[model samples]
Target: MDWLNYHHLLYFWVVAHEGSVSRASEVMHVTPATVSIQIRELEKALGVRLFRKAGRGLVLTEMGEAVYRYASEIFAMGRELIDMVRGRPLGQPLLFRVGIKDVMPKVVAYKLIEPTLNMPEQVRLVCREGDFSGLVADLAVHRLDVVLSDTPLDPNLKVRAFSHLLGESEVVILGERKLAQRLKENFPDSLDRAPWLLPTDNNVLRRSLDLWFADHNFHPVIRGEFEDSAMLKIAGKAGVGVFAVAAAIRSEVETMYGVELIGKIPSIKERFYAISAERKLKHPGVVAISEAARKRLQ
Candidate 1:
């Protein structure tokens, strides 16, 4: 491979950002033809086409996306370097991009990320909520600094990342005040034939709860199953049915949803994890989150 020309890379990066050579030329104060030539030279040096045409605009190819990711990081670091050399106090906060799995309880996610806000170095948090697989893909591509999930990353996935076990919490059952008062009488036995809101069967928590139910021989009447934890809690809050949450955030759940605690199931615990591209965490914000979560959950 030939030595990389940073000038060519800068042109390519600008064109990617602008989505067209003409717009990139306007930003860089160069002719459109100049930008095109520079990008073509970069493509030739890298031995791969970077952009593809779509609706009179350009979109990045798979390899192009990968290159763009690197180019972004490189330019970001370069800007930071210039700031340091100029002795300019960096008032701008560092960005901490994270992904939260959709099935994760919103309150739990907030607790895990809350410590980063108090760090000595300022940090701006950006959260992306999606399915675990999609979040894992973004983490693999370096788009997300970390991912918060109830379950650890599956080894079956080919992504190169490490799952750091933040900690685990016992599951706590909850219900509206009146329903909880009624069920609190019999404790575990009261769960039988009780109206219950539940997570969809595909969720890890739901699967674990299913085993616990089977072992205890409890047959609760299912009111509804939800993919969103917040919606399930909302239904539970309206006296739709009882639901469960992580004991670590039990107080917040009750306060936020105006629900009462039915009981805690110590036997059934929910684990939390932080998945990142690096085995050894380097980001200060990520480290703060991991540390805080372990302490809180423990």
Candidate 2:
């Protein structure tokens, strides 16, 4: 076999892991054309077809699957080597790529790590805010050094509870003035009458809320559904309907919009875990950030 190009191998690995050229392109911050070309070049050099088109996307062929298995191991070893060299005092500053769920307010995340960002030693802190599933998947693939998320890690991945108590709060924000007044007048009883803006039915938070409602026999009039907190907040502010949100995030919601929590429901709190590949714990940079975030957030 000809000497393999590391960059091409990386592109191939990402495409194989992501299972789609478009998704790999997003993670690599490159164009789909670039990824396709590189993968083609890699296949040409190896004298084997690595992928086959399936509908609009490419699926790894038998040879591609075999190569990907080895490629993953090779990349993992390369990362270990880089980490070992970077750990030396005279070597380059360690690069720590962390991922956080989009649900987490960026401002709060920044505030938590403000101190470490100014450290004298050259440390590269790259933070990517994304959905929980995508972030977790990336962490499992060694694309992220660490991930701060409310969701549980996959069975294949290793996770530790950095923050034992993930404190969250839920309150209904009434959009209409008449509805707000009625809610206030009726107090807790009015909760069942107002139209509610809820997270998606599959969201853990939403599930918790449903359970609470079931236990209390309080059925809310759900008017809208949102997958993103930002959108829920906006809808509430626009008087479209009532919305539920974390209490700690109330300040953020109030600052940007004119909305008030109607009645306090039981706070929805969960455990937040610091997730990473188990082998990644050997890296000093990964350990440092995990400890730092655990201390700050927990």
Candidate 3:
């Protein structure tokens, strides 16, 4: 059985955090040479160079950054354990990391994630936003507890992930007050040849909207395309064009962006999913989000 040398690991952790051997030596009350020797031994055991010289300062290598993350968690738990043994109240919050697909509506994401804050345990929520595939890649390696996306996991990605559909929302057309007022009476017919702000073709909502347009034979004048939902709504607020949002967040959109609903298309639904590496969700924060989002979206 191989045993890890926690003392050597401690030295490496301090050096990484302090960003220099000399500073770490001061923190540890040890000579710079002693700190250097301890870190070298740790690197030898781990078979990775944790730091590299950049100009006059030292920086962590790629592997070092990963190690530093683990070290941070390990030390945090160590302190918590000490507090537990002493019957002191634990101050550390449970860390819940989530990834959001860039195309996911910000209001929708906020609604879905809001429940985790009300959980019994103290939770520190961390959110990252990126493209779908990139977020899925983070989920595959366990960097993200779960990913919130408008679409389900693609089987072709070769990742072992399960997509739990939270719920679906009817699509709603929205525009600035005057534009919505002009179109409300005519509804679907009013949309024909109307200046339209749309999601780029790559988005699932865009594709669904395209299908709906074809089905109704409504030809909208495309004024602009956006990948960001917020930007699209901003343009709509300026009356640049009409836009679509999930009915689930219609009220929020109206309040936040000051846009009025032009019409609702129940036939066009926007679905949301919580994609996780686990076949069954086991994290408390994730479970809270999934349960609450399903109810909210429904």
Candidate 4:
């Protein structure tokens, strides 16, 4: 098959709009036969009839209508590209798709993304949360613009990604008011023999908390184990037991869950990261998030 020619398509486009070859030729500074032959060549290349007789004028065939739609968009985008490069605004909303690891706290995720959502320019945000490795894979293939994770990108994964350390903060033990008041004093010693709601064993926070407890020789009765941070906080509000969480959103947790802060463990820190295909951030939303987190978190 011959390669498609835009000249042929352009001639067909002009003839379609003008409704006849003679009218198109007059405007195009070509003979009617020249315009007709080019339209025939375009139809042959595409393997579809572009037009049919309707009274004295020409009307697009079904296949021609489909081609016309695509041609129209192609030309429109070309114009838009030119205008954009020339410093003209197209007013098109930017799309930002972010993937969050399932282990990440929703509140923390929201804090990280809030700045991007509040941008002056119009933007559409799409958030997906699930497996960390899978999310990293999506980012590698450009399926995701960025990814937020409680842990850094795994070094073992073959996928290429750069992890930007947003910040790290100490972990805080929280409980319902009644329980917190009882265990508030004597701090570390008070936590000994206390009823505790713990994160699932596999969790990074749980591992850190385990080490911290072992170091301090403070052992608590593990009442319940939760994989979901929000559920753990809910159980904390129900007085199930004290649970540990990152201290970055201290005020938000207090206000939203109405839980009491038992104490802050400065030694135990949880790091947050933004993973991307590029080392230097390019997406406007991602840049906003990384910059704002540097100032707001930690």
Candidate 5:
């Protein structure tokens, strides 16, 4: 085996963990072809086929499975070494990268940690925004130090949950009319009568809406779908349709777009969690951010 092939092992590890070249590519921010070529090169250098086709996805071969077991440990140790080097008495501030669900209010989330960011031990805060699954995947890959999200995580992930509150709110939006009389007149008994702006099908909020409709024997007339709440709010304000907005965001919606809350619908209360890998709880940056989120968002 080529002694310099350790770099390739990192690539292999990502592919194995992600279960697909395309997914690994997205996580690594590389092309699928690049990931495939590197994996092939790693296999060639090691003189074995690491994976074989299993239905639509790749499954590890016997050799591949054994290699993966060791690869995980090797990469983990490598990360520890890197951390050790960075944590040395350099007297410099340590940068902590944190991810938050885009659905969350950034002002509230940041204010929670504002004090910690100015500690004597230089602490730099890096914030990223994404949906629940994307943030979790980034955390699993070690790309993000910690994540704050309103969605529950998979049991397989090793996470420390700091907040347990089930925050419930209705999915509502300001109707087209600002005047109370006009809004009251336009209110419909069933949402099916109005064109609705919904989040993508995969979103937890969207799923809750679907469940509510099923229970109530109503189907919304979906005018369009959006991935971002800000965009949906814009569409709602423009009278494109009634868009879903969390109660937490109602004030922003009202202030920004003059949207009037027409009615409340039955939707599941969202659960917000400040989660990090169980192993990373001891890391000062992770600990600080987690505590901050728990204090404010919980």
Candidate 6:
């Protein structure tokens, strides 16, 4: 390519960031026609189309997203450069962007991220929660520094990421004080027909618990199905029914939910992973979380 023009790149970046030429022009204090001309010049310089219209909105094409990521970083660095040269004493905090799978237990997620807050280096943490697939998609695009999930990346899926096992622990079955006292009489057998709050089928722990239940023939009547693990715990705390939680965060759950522990399911354990681009972790915050989790959970 010929010598690049930072001006054209800036215009294209704003347009991509705003998702509309008109919006970008408003922010740039220029006309929509000027923004359009700049973007066209950028596309010609880069030799790749950046965006496509999707109905009323402009959406980034695959190449557009890739270019946007690079441009975002470049402009961010440029801003930092000015601050440093001016001796502004404005230190930019390191970004620790983590993507959490929707099914991950809230307590567990807190435990994992808590270490970043204590890092000696100033860190700005950002967390995004969604399904495994969507989070992986974000990770693939450099949007996420790391991904915390219950299950490893699917081998069938073509995501170029590796899973670092954080830790694993048995699960605890908890219920309200009254239900716990009543169920404590017969214990394991008592849960056979008891009302139970369960995670949806999308959760790995749920599938593992299903197998354990089948093996022991402990079929509890499903009281509710929740897509969010935190909601399931909330419902469980409200006496909706008994529910299971990772033993790693059992104490936190009991305290937060004010629930009594009924029993432990050691046979069915819940596993946690930190998915990232590197085979071996390099991020100090991520390393701290993984190290602390292994030591604490074990």
Which structure among the candidates has the greatest TM-score? 1
Compute each candidate's TM-score over C-alphas: 0.72, 0.59, 0.70, 0.70, 0.63, 0.71
Which lDDT tens digits does candidate 3 get at residues 1-298? 7778888988887787667899888867899999999999989998999999998779989999888777756754564455347532468787889999998888899999999999988889999999888787667545788999999998866455789999999999999999999989978889999999999998899999999889989998999999988899999999999999999999999998899989999898899999987777777878898889867895
In order, candidate lDDTs are 0.87, 0.67, 0.86, 0.83, 0.68, 0.83
Residue pairs clashing in model 3 are: none
Off by over 4 Å in 3: 1-90
Better by lDDT, candidate 5 or 1: 1
What is the per-residue lDDT of model 4 for residues 1-298, given as tens digits with 9 covering 90 to 100?
A: 5577988987886676556899889768899999989998888888889899999888888888778767655654544355347532467678788999887888899999999879998888999988887787667545688999888887866445789999988888888999999889989789998999887876788888889889989888999988888898898888989888778898898888889898989998888999987667767888999999987678
Q: Candidate 6, clashing residue pairs? A: none
How many collisions between residues are there in candidate 5?
Answer: 2
The TM-score ranking, best first, is 1, 6, 3, 4, 5, 2
Give the best candidate by lDDT: 1
lDDT of 2 by residue, 1-298 (tens): 5598888988998887777999999988999999989988998889999999999888889998888878877876776687677664566775678787776544345534454465666677888988776787776566787776656665533222122222233443444455566677676666775678887875666887788778768888887887676777677777777766555455656677677657666555533555655544664554554556555442
Model 6: residue 110 alpha-carbon error in angstroms:
0.9
Report the C-alpha displacement of residue 212, candidate 5, in angstroms.
1.0
Clashes of each: 0, 0, 0, 0, 2, 0
Please report, as a residue range, the 10-residue window in candidate 3 with the lowest summed lDDT.
Answer: 80-89
Give the per-residue lDDT digits (tens) of candidate 1, residues 1-298: 5598989998988787667999889878889999999999999999999999999999889999899878867765664455347532467887889999998888889999999999997788999999898898667545788999989889966456789999999999999999999999989999999999999987889999899899999998999999988899999999999999989999899899999999989999899999987767777788998889878995
Point out where model 5 deviates above 4 Å. 1-12, 18-58, 77-85, 88-91, 99-123, 127-141, 147-173, 176-192, 263-267, 273-280, 283-289, 295-298
Q: Which ten residues in a row have the lowest lDDT in candidate 5?
A: 158-167
Off by over 4 Å in 1: 1-89
Distance (Å) between predicted and true CA of 26, model 2? 12
Clashing residue pairs for model 2: none
